[model samples]
Target: MSLRVTFLGTGGAVPTTERAPSAIFVNREGDRLLFDCGEGTQREMMRAGTGFGIDHLFVSHLHGDHVLGIPGLVQTLGFNDRTDPLRVHCPPGTGDDLHDLVHAVGHQPGFPVRIEEVGPGDVALSADGYEVRAFETTHRTVSQGYVLEEADRPGRFDRPRAEELGVPVGPAFGRLHSGESVELEDGTVVESDQVVGPPRPGRKLVYTADTRPRERTVEVAEDADLLVHDATFADDMADRAR
Candidate 1:
């Protein structure tokens, strides 16, 4: 049950000495995910002590501050001799452009770079324990946000029921809580459901790369454990964002 998120950059078009650009790193139980690799993101990652072996990169749009780290990250991964393919995700209608951008660095990387273009409600990435959903955002150009959600876990263990079934209270309780059936010393079998309740709720995290405050952000980020929104400018400059 491990989920960690790091903001590699939080600035806009012009990166300052303080904030970099728009990159977020999520490590969910060893699944390394990078969102929006802005300019100098690789350097920022190094400075922040984040690992370099990222499995996926999600791009919100084609803005220079949001996607300028592609070539360098790909080259660095190659230099480090990474063999696994790198999955790059983007908004709809930019698959070909992303493909060209990765290859524009001159030579084919030692590892494969799989670029995928997605739209709202699409499942950008799914694994055994977690899923990432893409959602739309209102930006000058087309953009999409991401929501990281984990699978529901087994409910609390019913200790009384286990004891009533003659199941011991030590290791057997752990196995039962983990959804495994256990047999007591007396050979009485205890089913997992008899010792555990329904699945419990899981955690959710949302990342809205850069967009004017919109309804889509509200809908997708409801009850999220953490929501990283764009605070690019003040209220007076709100018109410029549109």
Candidate 2:
């Protein structure tokens, strides 16, 4: 499964003509997730052709630049006649604010919008093959980061070795690949380990939107395939940024 990440917006708190606010779209195996719906995020999505069919929206904070697009996105979806429910994950104590914004447009969308409050160390959302974990982040607001980690995948299957072991080229091969032992026609039990390699590490992506460098970010980003952290200021201005 190929994983694709689209930088919808990368500007700072103030959007520029070249860039919108802060929004990132991650599509892993076609399971789309939008991180931080900043100002004009829907327009950015349209421009990028990512569509508004996001599976989940993960907000890092309650800052206007970070979440100002929720109302517009909800209204756009309503105009498009969307019927599927949309789940929005946000930091603790900010769910109510997000709820207010969802309906701040003076009309509710035809779909159901669920606001989930997640704290540090909480599994915010669990999907078929991956999970979104929350981590502490240092920011002006009560913010948190997110880590999207996929489950370990099965190792490569040695088809030649399986066939050499007298295993048939049928369902037994699938069973062996699935880590199950299979008995052959001659009553010979073929172990999965003999034909399967060690388990492979799955892909991991971490997003720390608008946060200072924190230990939790480093911890969650360990061995991650992609780490998207905030760089609102340059290192030369580190002293002033604090």
Candidate 3:
């Protein structure tokens, strides 16, 4: 699996030539997921060549600096004829703001826009390969962070041996690779051990928008492959953050 994370904007609260705002685009094996789309994020995405392929946008909170680029992204996807449903995950009780964002693009999009208010312990999105889990985070306003957890992959597949055993390629081969036993046309029983390896761990990425350091964030980000956090203030300001 190939995963790439592009920091579209890395500045906090303000924008400059060196940095735009707070947005991170992640390409996890071709599934694009955006985290905290701040202002001008669409332009940043355009410059980075990250086309409007994102089907999901995870907003840490409803702050303007954290979610201003949603309209541009929505309109861009609409213009490109993206009929697939777009999902937005945000903090609880943000439906009104979410509605404003939905209608900000002049005309409604061709696809359905589903917005779900998420909080700690809520599983926003779960797929076969990975799951997005929200955790409690402390900030000036109510916020929730996200953790991208990948599922353990099945053991390695023995393609050469499967081919040598006269097993035809395709669905059957896929099933065998997934640790399923298959019977060949010659009545030979093929065991999963002949084609499957051991379980392997997957990569993890955690993103915590504007927030004070907390134990929950540490627990969720333990041994994460990538961690994107907002250190808005320096060590001296830590007391004020609390």
Candidate 4:
């Protein structure tokens, strides 16, 4: 399956006519993950054609613009009768923030939202042969970046070649695919290495949240298929952003 990334909001701190805030949509195998739900994130998601019901939301920081839309999105999902649980991930103390927001919004019922505070070395989401890892980022407050990667897939076995050699499709085929020697009923031996192709390489995507330039960010983005870095200002204003 192909992994695609859509920029929901690209502006930082402020919303522009062309860009909203800091939100992105990572689509993998029909799963939609939101990174940083800044102001107007729900509207931006709709504009980007990304359906509602995001299963996972990764908050880069506790900035107002970064997380201000959480309460609204939660209410919207409930209003639309969405039953699937939503998971929110951020640094420590994020649960308290979410709880306070929910309370401030009058605690809408029927929408189950799970808030998880995470730090470096945390796995935000893992399933369907893919995983997302969170790493701490340098910023005024606690922040983090994310790395999404696909698990390695086993090599494909040349079943047609085996069949042409009169090998039956049964336990012997399983053994050959699993890198083991298989002895046929007629005393013929088949080796896995002869039938299996090279293993498939995994794909990786990295997102650098709001943070100053640092070596860790470069390391996190190493060899990534997609590397998204926070560039809030022009090159001349780099020092100001830092």
Number of the top-ranking candidate, with lDDT as the measure:
2
Pairwise TM-score winner, candidates 2 and 4:
2
In the predicted model 1, the residue pairs found to clash are none
Ranking by TM-score: 2, 1, 3, 4
Whole-model lDDT values for every prediction: 0.88, 0.91, 0.88, 0.83
Q: Give a tens-digit lDDT track for model 3, residues 1-242.
A: 88899999889888888998899999888898999899999999889999878878999988888888888778888899888998889888886788798789465878899998888999999976999989889987889899999998888888998899888898988888777889988899898888888888888999999888889899999989999998888898868666
Worst 10 residues of 1 by lDDT: 98-107
Off by over 4 Å in 4: 156-190
Model 2 clash pairs are none
Residue 130 lDDT (model 4): 93
**Candidate 4 lDDT score relative to the true structure:** 0.83
Cα lDDT tens digits, model 2, 18-48, are 9899899999888889999998999999899
Worst ten in a row by lDDT for model 4: 101-110
What TM-score does candidate 2 reach?
A: 0.93
lDDT of 4 at 225: 83
Tens-place lDDT per residue, model 1, 196-227, is 99998889999998888888799899989999
Task: Candidate 3: list runs displaced more than 4 Å.
Answer: 105-107, 158-173, 182-190, 236-242
